[model samples]
Target: MLVVSTGDLMMFGISAVALIVLAYVIQKTRLGRALRAVSFDRDTAQLMGIDSTRIIQLAFVISGILAGIAGVFLGIKYTLYPTLGSLVVKGFIASVIGGLGSLTGAVIGALLLGILETLLLAALGSGYSTIAVFAVMLVFLLIRPQGIAGSNVQEKA
Candidate 1:
């Protein structure tokens, strides 16, 4: 494929979008709330009549469907290597670095990372791209540990 002979960023970009939509659904729906409740307190949600196992199943199904779509892009991006996800590790890290457990945070982080990656790869070179993004994340972590829009809200006392 052209991507293997040449590192193709288009594949990553498309796959990122597909996955983000799936992630958004997971974040916005009532099912999503049930899952979040289970996550926040499994016993409490169960007491409130939410079935945790069913929610977990839904999560797995959602993840699998998204991963399958991503696989197509990966298949195009790189060869049939065992470590298919490795190529996009930095992107995933960016999603987390922007804000784990925060969907908007992850998205904003991903876009910024993409822009940063593009600019640095253009100006400095791909060799320094990783370092630049990591540096930015490190600085953010040292400063606003709560991440962008991360509420400092603790559970009700």
Candidate 2:
């Protein structure tokens, strides 16, 4: 049987709320618009007087802050070790599975990966479950490299 603690529930709630707030900030703010523009095309954003350099800097700062917060949350939930950073591979896999640049896609991919991993672990064992997750990611790469929510974007010359 599976058991969940209040700490786990609180963590889930905090994570969900954080994601929602981030989505809102990305979708509905002037900073968000500038960020999207700069990310899409730095040259064009600069040409349009959007201060691409500043936006890029801000982006990095924001990412660093988020990463730090995530690290703290992770430490709260699990033991810290030198090898703990290796688990970031799962985040990479989830992002790729959902589509690289899409936040919603990443969330969906994470949930799907978690569900698949949990089911496999329950049925089989940890060894096979890890292999199966990798296999699933391989299939996604081969079949739909753009990911579930990613659209093919043509680069300008």
Candidate 3:
């Protein structure tokens, strides 16, 4: 059976729009700036009059909402299964590839991963696609452990 359908395309469009909106909110809103400040340093943000706890709570709520949306979409696309939670590996890989904490990186990484997976599936079959993806990720980590959008920093031990 074909996996791609009109419904899937519609869902993909909706997801894309949602992601774009989220990225914009994270990049251009006051809450986003506060979140960034908190992420950079909670103590400093607190000193600057930002409520770190509130920001953290808001972040958790936003994360939960997004996760719920993703879960619903996944259920609709692939149906509920015992191993559904394991599918998060793709998101983890994409996040790693794009850059651990960068919104733009995550979006780019996911898009690139999706394209790569589709190409690999067509060329090497489904069995080998995951292997190739992981192999590529390993090579990427070996060469650029900071990820595509992550900046290199020297940490003092």
lDDT of 3 at 96: 79
Q: For model 3, how does the per-residue alpha-carbon lDDT over 1-157 read when each residue is reduced to its tens digit?
A: 7677898898889888889888888899999999989888788899999999999999999999999889889878896889888779999889879988878888888999999999999999999998999998998799988789977744533
Window of ten residues with lowest summed lDDT in model 1: 1-10
RMSD of each: 4.9, 1.5, 2.5
For candidate 2, the TM-score is: 0.94
lDDT by residue (1-157, candidate 2, tens digit) is: 7799998888888888888878988999999999989888888899999988888899999889778878888999999989898779889889889998899899999999999988999998998988998999999999999889987766766
TM-score of every candidate relative to the true structure: 0.73, 0.94, 0.90
Q: Candidate 2 clashing pairs?
A: none
Backbone-clash count (model 3):
0
Report the alpha-carbon TM-score of model 3 versus the true structure. Answer: 0.90
Better of 2 and 3 by lDDT: 2
Ranking by TM-score: 2, 3, 1
TM-score of 1: 0.73
- Poorest stretch of ten by lDDT in candidate 2: 148-157
lDDT of 1 by residue, 1-157 (tens): 2233333566666667776676766688888789889777878899999998898898789778877776776676568977655657776666556676676777778787778878899898877877887788888788876677454535643
Where does candidate 1 clash, by residue pair?
none
